[model samples]
Target: MEVAFSGINIYSKKPEAVFEFYKKLGFRVLEEVAPDDKWYGSTLALQDGDNAPIIWIWRQSDEDNSVVCNHFVFSTNGKMDEVYESIVAAGIACKPPFTAVWGGRELILHDPEGNELLFL
Candidate 1:
């Protein structure tokens, strides 16, 4: 058997803000479902001119089924520091870059909805 990771789904109360946050990180919208419609969500990917999406952000509602996590980590192509600086400059509260015990330089921050994210 063989498997490959495609993308992750994120549930957020502020889906638009989350989408904008990812956009600032250089991710482009692969697809987006307007909030006025039944399924409100968006798929995003690194803007390397590829069609592969890396993350999906779904609008959460009182009736929606979803899972919440304290944090998640994303691997970077050695631009972690630059990304971290950019995010901080944007006025978002982000921890300074530091070496992770798991063996990589990492920076931590929270999304508009308070979901912690670690960039490695």
Candidate 2:
């Protein structure tokens, strides 16, 4: 047997809103999956062109089919505070920014679809 994780998919009622949310945090939309994808929304990818694995997100209803999807973590060079600023500018409600035990700044916020983004 062979196993390799491809990406993460998050169901959202407002995937585009979630898209814009992540785009501010540095993710690019690779393409939409369906033609009338407005119902199922889209699939987004974060690609830097260096063999970096891409993350995928989908827009779908969670009324029935549901599973586990944790918050995504992002690593920054040195703009943790800049992230805080962006959140504030976006007027996005985020958990209070704080330092972690490993001496990293961390922040948590939920997308319109209810997925969490843990920025560190």
Candidate 3:
């Protein structure tokens, strides 16, 4: 089968809170699956300008899960600064969104899960 980039596995300690964070970035939860239904995790299906999902939050295990997958990048249509300011204003500790070595500006946030989300 032809393959394309699907989504990230964001394992959260407290997924409900993390879900709110993504909601600020405009990711709407299309469908939510319970832990028992899918092994201690929730598949938060979200959309961002495309029908396909670009990010996912799978809350499993305990708080010790740190920095899942180095980092995950989310498209923001070049509004990095705005997104950064918004997150900062909300009291979420994060570095100012800036141009990355990958050639796109992104806002880096370390969620309570200790996992980093790069808002590009």
Which candidate number would show the highest TM-score if scored against the true structure?
1
lDDT tens digits, residues 70-89, model 2? 67777655787887887787
Cα lDDT tens digits, model 3, 28-65, are 67666664544344444555555475556666666464
The lDDT ranking, best first, is 1, 2, 3
Measured on C-alpha atoms, candidate 1 has an lDDT of 0.77
> Which pairs clash in the backbone of model 2?
none
Indicate which candidate wins on lDDT. Answer: 1
Stretches of candidate 3 off by over 4 Å are 33-41, 45-51, 62-67, 89-91, 98-106
Candidate 1 ranges with C-alpha deviation above 4 Å: 47-53, 65-67, 100-104
**Local error of candidate 1 at residue 97 (angstroms):** 1.1
TM-score of each: 0.73, 0.67, 0.60
Checking candidate 3 for backbone clashes, the offending pairs are none
Against the true structure, candidate 1 reaches a TM-score of 0.73
Model 1 RMSD in angstroms: 2.9
Clashing pairs in 1: none
C-alpha lDDT score of every prediction, in listed order: 0.77, 0.67, 0.65
